[model samples]
Structures are given as structure tokens and as C-alpha cells.
Target: MWRDEAATWQVAQRSTAEIWHLLANVDVVHGLYYLLMHVLFTCFGPGTTTLRLPSVLATAVAAACVAVIGRRVAGSWAGLAAGLAFGLLPAVQFHLQEGRSYALVAAGAAISTLFLTTVLQRPARTRHWAAYSTTVLLTGLLHWLSLMILAAHLATLLWTRAGRAVLARWAAAAGCAVAGVLPLIVFSRGQSVQVAWIPPLTWHMLIGPAVLLAIGGTCALPDRPRAGRLSAATVGLPLLAVPQLGLIALSLLQPVFLDRYVLYSMLGLALLIGAAVGAAVRAARPRFPTASRWILPVTLAVAMSALLPQSLATRSPASRVDDVLAIASDIRHLKRPGNAVLFVPPLRRDVKSLTPDAFAGLRDIALAVPPEKSGTLRGVETAPDRIRAALLAEQRVLLVTDASPGARPARGARDRMKTAVLHRYFVPVADEQTRGRRVIVYERRSTPR
Candidate 1:
């Protein structure tokens, strides 16, 4: 999305500054993120791999950062576990496969939070302060949502340490942050859309992050809590699990809630919980055997890891690069000017249509509605009247219906395109198949004599 949309916007505007001009008012703070991504993609050359390269490298670098920070917080063993766990996380794995900035957001958020914590705990550390400021500013520029993570970091910093130190550092950082981000702050005032939600913390949601954290955090947490079983379970499981639960609930209603965005929050909770459990276990000999403490955490981790889906439902092939290339080639060959492309009933959210996904590849092919916007355009056209109103412009109208043959709207949409109401407007030319998925193509029929 970042690649295709930014590529189109930048091409239309012709310069980085112009790209900023178009988006700054529209996306507000998020415009800066697209602006920066625009600069990099231009330099790297326009393609998904080129566009998303920075995020891949950033994820690798973030894993390394985790290890370094973990060692500082706990010990070498804990650092290794934390780094490895983050790299292998199911959420991280999913985001890494996409050509988006979320992975970089995870990296920047994690590194910045580490700096904020370090500076708060050891107030006199100037180096950590400088580093914290840089990452926080960069993260804000990278994504507006990064601000939320920064808010959580600042809250934790103020709450964790006592009066003068916490107040002083937070004030200084907040001032710097605001001054640097004045541009986005001014722009994001009116255009944004929001979805409200009631938080859901269910059993399935808790299982994964909780188990991973307990396993990874064990190395760092103190030994006394570590000795017994109950201490480990309580600290290790719920601490990390809770935030993931919050995220999962948010995601269902608003699909915008991606897994990687709150990964830093998960790690923070995990470390605290694991340390508590380890400490309690060491305090006394428990009813269960000494091995049971280790045994249970290990068992849960293995089971949970197995359950998380490694391959998400892709709109195309599971291999994102191959899928994009395949679609792009198809667009180059099949799409031509004067060929009217229609997006009827927009593609279903659950079902990924090849048309929108392959739009960027079509070069100059005029479309019914641009691919990036197919969803919104479809949503806006409610009844048959609205769909009919939108259809009058194109000589050829292509209907994008869900694959379910039994759905009422899908049948209606197909029927409408068949020319029951507008007899002279369209004729079916071809039916394109994408990996067993279907996209029907149509052209305008001649007007009656």
C-alpha cells in the first residue's frame, strides 16, 4: 500500500516537497511519514522490494537493539532470549512479509522506549537522553500512531521513577517532541477518521504473547521468584498477555490495528511479569517439584507458538513479491486505454480481488475507481440507484462482486451489469482468473439503432 499509493502520489506531484503539499493537509501528521518514504523510494527506484527494504533492515536491526537493551535491563542470557523471541514472534513475522512501514515502527518504538526508560532510571545519562530524543522524533515522523506508543512510554517513565527526575525529563522531551512535530500537528486536525471500540480481552488472544514472554523473560527475572511454579505463571503470563488482548479486540472492529504496532508494549509487560515470577519461585520450595516451574512455561510456549497462523490469507499468493510481480505483468499486458474498468460492489473485505491489487501495474489504464480507493467508493454506493448513478460515466462497467455465488448483492450486481436496465452500455469481453480467483472484464456494447 505504502509503495503503490506513495508511488502514484509522488509521480503525480513530481517532487518530494510537492508530495508533502498534497498529503500534509489530507493525512495531517501521517503525511510526513509518506513524504520520507517517498524520498527513499525515489532514491531506491520504485518497486515493492525497494520501497519496503528499509523496514526489513530495520526489523533485523531492532532485534539487535533488543538484545543490547535486554542485557542492560537484565543480563546476557535474558538479552539473547528477548532478541530471539522478538525476531521469531508470530506478529513480527506477519508484518515483515508485507511491504509496509509497521516493522520500522516496531523498531523505532522499541529503541525509543528503551532510551526513555534508561534516561528516567538513570537521570544523569546524557547519551541515552540524546538517543531517546532522536528516535522519538524519527518515530513520530515515521507514523502518527508512533505517538501513542510514545505516550505510553512517557506515562511509564513518570510513574516508574520519583518526583523531580521524572518531571524534569518528561517536560524537556515533550517540549522537544512538540517543536519538531509542529508541521504534522497542524495538518492532522480535520481529515482523520476514527472508529470507537469496547476493549475485548478473550482467552484465545491471551494465549500466544503470554507464553512467549514467560519463556523469554525467564532468563532475566530474578531467581527467587524463579524457584516456584505459581510465581512464574502469574508474572510471566498475564503481564505480556494483557496488551495483546487489547490489540486483538481493536483489530476485529477496525482492521487497521496491526499486530506489530504494539510489540514494545508486550515486551515491557513480559519482562516485568517474568521477573516477578522468577523472584517468587526462588523465595520458597513449592509443593510441585523444582522442575515443574520450568516445565510448565516451556509447555505453554511450544503449544501457543504452534497455533498462531504463519501464513495469513493473502489477496494473492502467499509470496508477496511474486504475487505483485505476477499482477503487474498481467496489468501491463491486459490493460489498455479506452478500456473501461469497473469496480462494482467493491471487493469484499474478507475476499481479496486481484483487480485492485493489480491496479498500479496497469500503467495508464483508466479505472472505474482507483485501486487504493475501491473499498471506500463501493461503500459510498449503497443501493441500486447509487450504483446506477456511478455507472453512467463509463461506456464499460466491470462489476467486482464477492466469490460467493449465493449472495444477493453479488447476484444483483452481476445482473445489473448484464444490461437488464441499461441495454446498450456494456458487453462481456473476457473472464480473468487469478490463482483460481475470478475477475470478469466487460466493454461497452453499441447503442441501439
Candidate 2:
């Protein structure tokens, strides 16, 4: 998790103007988050705690908002149960420590939905609608994909048949949000290459939404006629279904179905589960008053026990696809002053950017310009001929590459040359592999003849 956190930290390390320039061309979706982290880094200095604190706090606020939604739609017991269930969610816990926009996006979704509920319930307050629109706009600024939550809100409004007046207000608010996000959408489109790695919809993607619906349906079954069930289904069902399904559907044309993108949807599941548990407890009270009193406590205890392993695993380095801190430590131990480093694809140079301090003693032999100077994350690389010459000239070269199985098979002319140079002039001296990356040291076998 913190492996990707380095990208956030790298953006934070730049000057505000530099960050703004970088965002104009790429990463516009996370522009607002980087700005917020810039302020945090300025005040607290860039440490793991400072980097991740906002996400933790945002998660706490989102959990509180879920409780409020549960109370409004169901009851006090439902609210408590919903909030507790939210905190125990594996997805929620995973993003809490991440220094990214996902947690903030989830928080924005919760708060904006809370406001949407108020506007629907009252249907007269212009201010409520304004607040809702503003929150939606802000959420989109944090991460444009969060606007998907508005589709769920639209579905909920339509399902409830919340009078023409309420529907009109929601439409107006949603239009304003769309307008607010238009510029970012345009800029992000220019950077569409970022999401190219998203695979097409799979059985797992289909199963995720189906499982959520099953849980919600089970909850709704127990109290079909109750206002609580109706409200929960109206709001929760779409929130759990639409974002994922919409993304999956769109993935056929363009891939974007990532679980973290819709992490907020879990709030809907929690609300339904909480309402069902509360209903079950009430239904059992008359038959077994003593056991009914124990229901909430026992349920929470059991839930926590089930979630304990996942929560603990979330803190381990293995939980992340890569661990920048661990990689940095390895580089520190293995590298000597003036050692030359080569990122196989050149883009892999980002690994050094993540742990700049550890790489201070080393030199990027193929770098033609620094990242800040080039206005790119990985920086510009030297020409292919220059890279080959540089590699041959070095006594020891550190090769960094993706940890994937196919990484050794050269995929492009540049990579082929890199492999050829390494094999023709050098011998492997040492190697280390991590979850996300591989590091190998090659020593000159003989003088370049």
C-alpha cells in the first residue's frame, strides 16, 4: 500500500507550481489530494504518520456519516451496528493507512449521500441541495471516478419516486457537479494511458456486486414491509450495485473496474446489514429477553473476531504489492557511493524516486533529465546508444525491473539492448526479489575490449 504512497509523497515534495504544472498534463484526478498533502507535509514534514493521518481521520468521519445515515433510515441500534460494521470492513481498513485519495473519496461519498438524503426528506431547503452539490463537486475533484456515486444517488431518487421537485433539485445539483468536473475530465482524458493496466471484467468482478446484492436482499427479506427495509434498499442497493456494474459495463469499451474506486459502496452494505441485525434482535427480544440483550455485543464480538486477521494483515509489508521502505533499506545496504543504476524499461526509475534518500549515493546512468525538469514521474532517459555506451563503461550496474515472470524476456528494442549489454559484458553478482520489483547487481567480467 505504502509502495504507491511514494507517488503521493513525491508529488508532495515538489513546489506548488511544479505540482500544478504536472497535474495540467497528467494525474489531474489526484491534483486536489496532492495539494492537501503538500500542506500537511509543509506543516508536519513528510513522515509515514503525517502522510497517512488524513486518510485515517477521513475514514473515521465516513464511519460516523454511515451511522447517521443508518439512524435516519432505520434506528439507533442500526446506526451503531452500521458504524461498527463499517470500521471492520476489510476494504475500509486497507485504505485507512494508504496515502491516497480513496479514503477521502469514500468520505465525500458518505457526506454527500447524507446531504442528498436530507434534501430528499425535506425537499424545500435550497441550502441542503447546495451543500450536496458542493460536496459532489469536491468529491470529483478528489477523484473523478467518485462521481459514480452520484449515479447511485440518481437511482435511489428515481426508485423512491421522491416527487418531481426533489428529482429536479437532484438533477440540477448533479449537473453542477458534472460541470465542475468537466475540466478535470478533459485533462485526465489526455492522460488516459494511466488506466491501461485495468483488465477486462472477470468472474470476480461480477461476483463482487452479486455478493453485495445477496447480502442486501437477505437483509431486505426479513423486513420487507418496514420503512427501514424500503429506505435501506432504495439507497443501499444502488450504491452497492450501480458504480461497480456501471464500471464493469463500461470496461467493455474502456477498463476501469477497480474495487477501491467504489470503496464507499461498502457503506451501503453495512447499513443494510445493521438494519437486518437490529430487526433480528427486536424480533428475538420477546422470545428470549436475556439473549436479545446480548445480541449486539455478541454480534460485534463475532464480527471483530472474524475481521481480526485481515486487519492485522493490512499492516504487514506483504499486504502491499510493493514496499518502498523495504526496497529503500535494501538499496542502502547493497549500494556503494557512485554506483551506477539502470531501470530496465526506464519507467522503473520511479523506484528510485520513491526512496530518493537511499539512492543519493548512486547514479542513474541513463537519466538525461531529472523528473522535475522533464515534468514527468520517471524523468527522460538518455538516448539508446548513450545508454548502451554508459552500461559498458560501468564496472558495476544495478538493474531494477518489474517482478513479473516475463520481465527477463526483452519486449522492446531498448530492453533488448539493455539485456544484450548486461549479458555480453557483465556477470550477475547479487540479486533480490520483492513482491513488486526485482533488483540485480551485475559486475564487469572483463574490461570492454
Taking all chains together, each candidate's TM-score versus the true structure is: 0.63, 0.94
lDDT tens readout by residue for model 2, 173-291 = 99999899999888898898878867877776788778877887788665463332237667777787778777777788888888888898888888888788778787888999889
Candidate 2 global TM-score: 0.94
Candidate 1's C-alpha runs over 4 A off are 1-14, 120-123, 158-160, 182-186, 194-263, 269-316, 319-338, 344-429, 433-438, 443-449
User: Which candidate leads in TM-score?
Assistant: 2
For each candidate in the order shown, give its overall lDDT on alpha carbons: 0.50, 0.82
- lDDT tens string, model 1, 1-449? 42233333333323555554446334444455565666766677656666556667877877776666555545454455556555555566656555556777777867775665465446456666667777777876766555565455544543344467656766677668656866665556454442222234456655665675555456434533332222222222332444455566556655445445565554554344334433444443365556635643573477456744453443225323222133334444555654444443343311223234545332222234432343221223245555455456556544333233423443455446534534456566755544323445556567631
What's the CA error at residue 266 for candidate 2, in Å?
A: 0.9
Candidate 2 CA-lDDT value: 0.82
lDDT of 1: 0.50
